[model samples]
Target: MKNIIKTILLSVAVLGMSSCSEDKILDLKPVNNILSPDAFTTPTLIESYMNGVYNAAAIGQYNSTGANGGRGYVWGAAYVEQGECRGEDVVNMATFYDLTYSSTFDATSANNVYYWVDGYRLINRCNLMIEGTTDAVAKGIITKAAGDDYIGQCKFLRAITHLELLTYFARPYNDTPGATHAGIPYRVVGVNTQAEIDSETVKPRNTVADCYTKILADLNDAETLITTGNSTAFASRVVGRASKWAAIAFKTRLYLQKRDWANVIVEGNKLTGAFALTADPYAPFQNTTGRNTSNSESIFSIQHAATSNPGVNAALASMLKDRALVCISPIIWRDADWKTDDKRREEGKFIYTAAGIKYTNKYTDVTNRTDAAPVIRYAEVVLNMAEAQARLSNSAPALTLLNSVRNRSLANPFPTAGNPVGQAYTAASFATDADLVKAILKERRIEFLQEGRRWTDIHRLQKDPIASVATNGVPAKVASAATPPTAAFVLGNSFAITTPVAAIPYDDFRFLWPIPQIEMNTNPGLGQNPGWN
Candidate 1:
């Protein structure tokens, strides 16, 4: 096991290079060790090689600014999915932050750097593993089942990467717009044929139909491969890492984007039975049971192993350490020196002298450890079920589903001494499916905040005005320009934090990120998204 870990660490660490130029240093063992057909000559070798693919897809440099740069690399796609502006955009006057930036014609420099390289780098690793595994199996190294499982995990990873790209680069799946917009550059299987290599050549944008067809194909394939599989803590699982449920989840997600509510409901219900929410909703991240919890609620989760203690410092040190400047936000900033309980005039965290730091329940027990990152959780399944039900006009039961999650937040949504005022949810008298959806969407915002789903959900639910928060609705008014009191997260007294009622002010043009200028200059066929110049 130790040797397997070491063998793959070199390859996994190399995935951190996506942020840099193609000339970026190669951190993996020689492409020779990577490509050695002989190396995968054993079942162990093939299994070890599979590790490289998972790590590459899931982990990234902890120091990079956004979640895209590190272990929560999914954060990038989530951000784009919801049209989240970079945290920097809140204060950076020079940059235009919104869906307008996502437009291929007018993307910001930061947006371009994060989204493009992250997805492609993941895609490349997936391709390498897929191609390599086939050779190993052909040469009689791995059993048919072993090969099937590896391929399943690989396909699942690839499907997510492509869908993530599609949400940003292509139009949402609709019979109308999908056919017009360009889907991402699609490729599958071995790059053996001239046609295959040429397929990489600039083909004009795929119809939204074609883009979805490609994604569904990958996910369906993943469904077959992952259902009967099992993997260790660092690997995939049956109905686990991009497993049957995940494939279904993604399909539900895809159909939601496609605005196909009936199908979304069908797929989402299947996910519901996969994982039952635990009695204590926050137990998944409690320091004690966090790392090892496999309750029914978690349909799919990318498990992280600790190399160090699990304190916030260790849990998030890699990303927060060098981000002294980035941590100024109200979350877990590194150099903010904000050690107190003054909520109104607060910093990243409220230092509870007694309870310690105010941490997100998504991860607890950050006392002195590098806690594993849970990418997907049972709570999400509960949330997904509630949402799908609401979208399908099951309003009465939907609200019940919604309340199940809301009742669980640290700030219980029902309103209490802890959370003084519950997030409001109404419209029980709604006349149609659309009305119930509005309630469901709002419920999602309160449920998934900061977990990196807000922005993406906002993007997915854009058509409905109430579903997405407008960032620029009104400029925030700070108590004092120099020493602005905490406003967004604050609702407090003189000593308590008093957050401003911030709104999401979106610009039409920044919808799809501008294609990277570097890519455009090099890959002539790589046309930009709509609005970016």
Candidate 2:
């Protein structure tokens, strides 16, 4: 469940994940401000308007479950039918979690929708401001130089919104791509041509690839515009807003998705000295004093106010010190296999309870006060670099970086075993680079459990499958259609189709979301994505 605090996050960066009510504020704007429209002719008014757009981007539901139920119960029921750990192609995403879906919009989920709409809404506003300011500059209402800077900020805000939307609404740019797929409508300038749109709106969805290109263009444009100085992580120029480094960091992630391995190696190499890995990987998440521990490892994060969503997101006074929603399950316990030293998990998730049962304390606020929510940590760079090297057949040295991270998590140096073959440790048992990658996925899971990275990592790797807990399964109708039913059964009767892999392959048609049925009915031009019925 998400906490619905009415307070704004103490934000430095304009990564505006706030609880502020914009529609109310906008509706209640002073008549003179609306009437004078001339007020927005000045640089001060234009900048203030631009800042509001960032506020729109940050405010969204921290979590939203389905109409049927939240993950635990629905997942609990799902596991009973499928006998699988968890179907990663979760059915609720497009159906239940989509804020744009007609019935799902509410204040709880409104932030995400509002955040998105606000960005575009602001984009329209920016366009209006630019047009007006140009007219004003020509007539002496404002200066041309001031107007240019304001427009650049608008571009950055527009790009950031699109990027976030692309990540959420569309499939990963690297996989089941947006090229053939229809991305969210690309709205640049504000236009509510509803009547005209109803009759003549023929905007074809851009391919996911096209959306990525647009995102890159905006970021590139933002870099050129925002390249002055970004010292503070949360300054008005940097925090709550996109900065040059923040843009690059985001670019790096996009490139990684496209599997531009060379760029991954290059960009990752270039960032060599920027991030510092923690001796204890969990410290960045649990240490209150060391919340921004990843100031060394993390590139950027949309810092939240301790008041908005409270601990449900990241802030003080939010039972994060004492409460638990996002916690380690038996999945990690089973995955760790009792083989590796518990050093990482011990430091990362587990704390001895009064009865001595090892209870997870990672999300416990004060006891393991890791206030920082990492967006991109240095270890990811290290992992990405190693992955790049492995992909390049230079895996012999990849272990150096891998070992660098592994050693820190270990209680003591692992005594080398067996023999040595060239750079390959003879005693170590990874038959090939593929084996190493499998290991990397396993390591990533151990390190990033409950950090919102598991499902996405699967999108990128698409190679390995970890075992899911006694959870996750596909609908019987779907599973039988492909593999064919071994038997017939009633809907309520419980049955299981056990599989070794944790994540079941999504029925092929499920690769992308069905264009919402309403959209299909209303807009003949908008086509549905493949795999939907």
Candidate 3:
């Protein structure tokens, strides 16, 4: 009976099989696998299981089909693409487009559903590692120290995966500080038996606050267990695993989402001298010469080798190349007024061709999908601190931090002379805290253009009801809080100009994606988010 139970628990359920784009929901293909009582007895087996957890966590939207960039789902770089596509930062060319830009996606939407399904898949893997590690220690299969390390890593993945789900599924925690908004069900235990699966499935969703509490606890525990003592040796391994600093950085992001401005500052300060910005503007992204080794800048990145990448069609190169499916928005080129010599505009970063198309070069290698997926970077922490300070009305300090990022892009450190060429912003640019805050926001848009953050940033800042680029021959530069203009200009099929596009309101129901319909179907206790039934 025990052997049968172990097999049932270890077997891959239909619910466990995740696809590239997360579109497919099929029947279970159970494997006859079981964890013997002493499966975690060897260090090598434990390491292999932990690596599997990492692999599961890194899987994002990449579907390897012929259509849709010949890919099923685009995961790593696709996150940046999907997040920015909905916002005003990037554009799609004639050949490629998706529901991300459409005003129609909701709870039944496959893209949104994928986030929930894939996230829990990651969490489940982590839970298994956590359980196996604990069991190994209890059975004297591994030392207490080794067990702690395994447990810490698994918990860190679980925490971040849960947080990512909340970012999509639940309203921002700050949206309703004291209110009871249903967040995704918090499951920490690995499902091994039918009873465990049933129990977890029917568990009611936790309140957003309660969910946050769990996320923070996991992060804090991870921080305690993950080591940073062996910096030199660990640097090579840190790209794939969570380090002590990585846990702290994740907390910084979590605080920002919760709108805990002071806590953001508090947590961000922990990385004071831990990481530095890459001296060259584009050095951090080069797959061959750059970022092959861990640096002070990258806290954690998903590792993809030359032999193993997300796929051909699912890479950023496929989506944002000159003749590629997606393109950069004209607004970024025209309205935002990017400098001519900006390193970001250099041939490899953004390409401008004779046909008047713009492509981002962040993911330059298409044939070999070895580009590391950046989860967190040192620069983001600096900006988060800058924004937090500005919000707290700490004027002088915020501007100083903001200028550091601005100076790096131009390759011209500030407090020098006149505006050096390629410089995006300067120290004397803003006068008030609000002005500094706005500049910081603008800088974030420029900095993380293809890093999959525009929509969430827009959502967090409450910058909504965004209007079209050109309305009746004039630029609707600033997002309108009032009613949007009808017949707004847009790039449509074949790059043709389409007009009268509706603006999304700040409190639009679509802003908060509906709970995945299948999840609601399976878990009767789960309730749908507002505006999607």
Per-model TM-score on C-alpha atoms = 0.70, 0.63, 0.82
TM-score of 3: 0.82
User: In model 2, what lDDT does residue 234 have?
Assistant: 26
CA-only RMSD, every prediction: 8.2, 10.8, 6.6
lDDT of 1 by residue, 206-292 (tens): 666776788888888887887443333322343225666667777766776666767766776765544555565445544555442
lDDT of 1: 0.47
lDDT of 3 by residue, 1-533 (tens): 33222211111221332221223432111111225333466877777777656655554432222211222222345466657666765654442444565445766666666556556755776787798889888988888888888888878888887777676667667567562678877878776555666556667888989988999999999988866332633345466687777788888888877778899899888878767777766766775434423565777776666644445555555556534666555556443445545667666454534344556777666666667777778788889999889889897778878867766776444434564443435546667667777777777878777777776676555522221211211111222111122212222323323223345665667666677666676654577777776
TM-score for candidate 2, please give it: 0.63
- After superposition, the stretches of candidate 2 with alpha carbons farther than 4 Å from their true spots are 1-47, 61-164, 167-179, 191-201, 228-241, 286-290, 310-323, 337-343, 347-372, 414-429, 463-504, 511-524, 531-533
- The full ranking of all candidates by TM-score, starting with the best, is 3, 1, 2
Which is superior by lDDT, 1 or 2? 1
Candidate 1 TM-score to native: 0.70
For residue 108, model 3's alpha carbon misses the true position, in angstroms, by 3.6
Would you list the C-alpha lDDT of every candidate in the order shown? 0.47, 0.43, 0.62
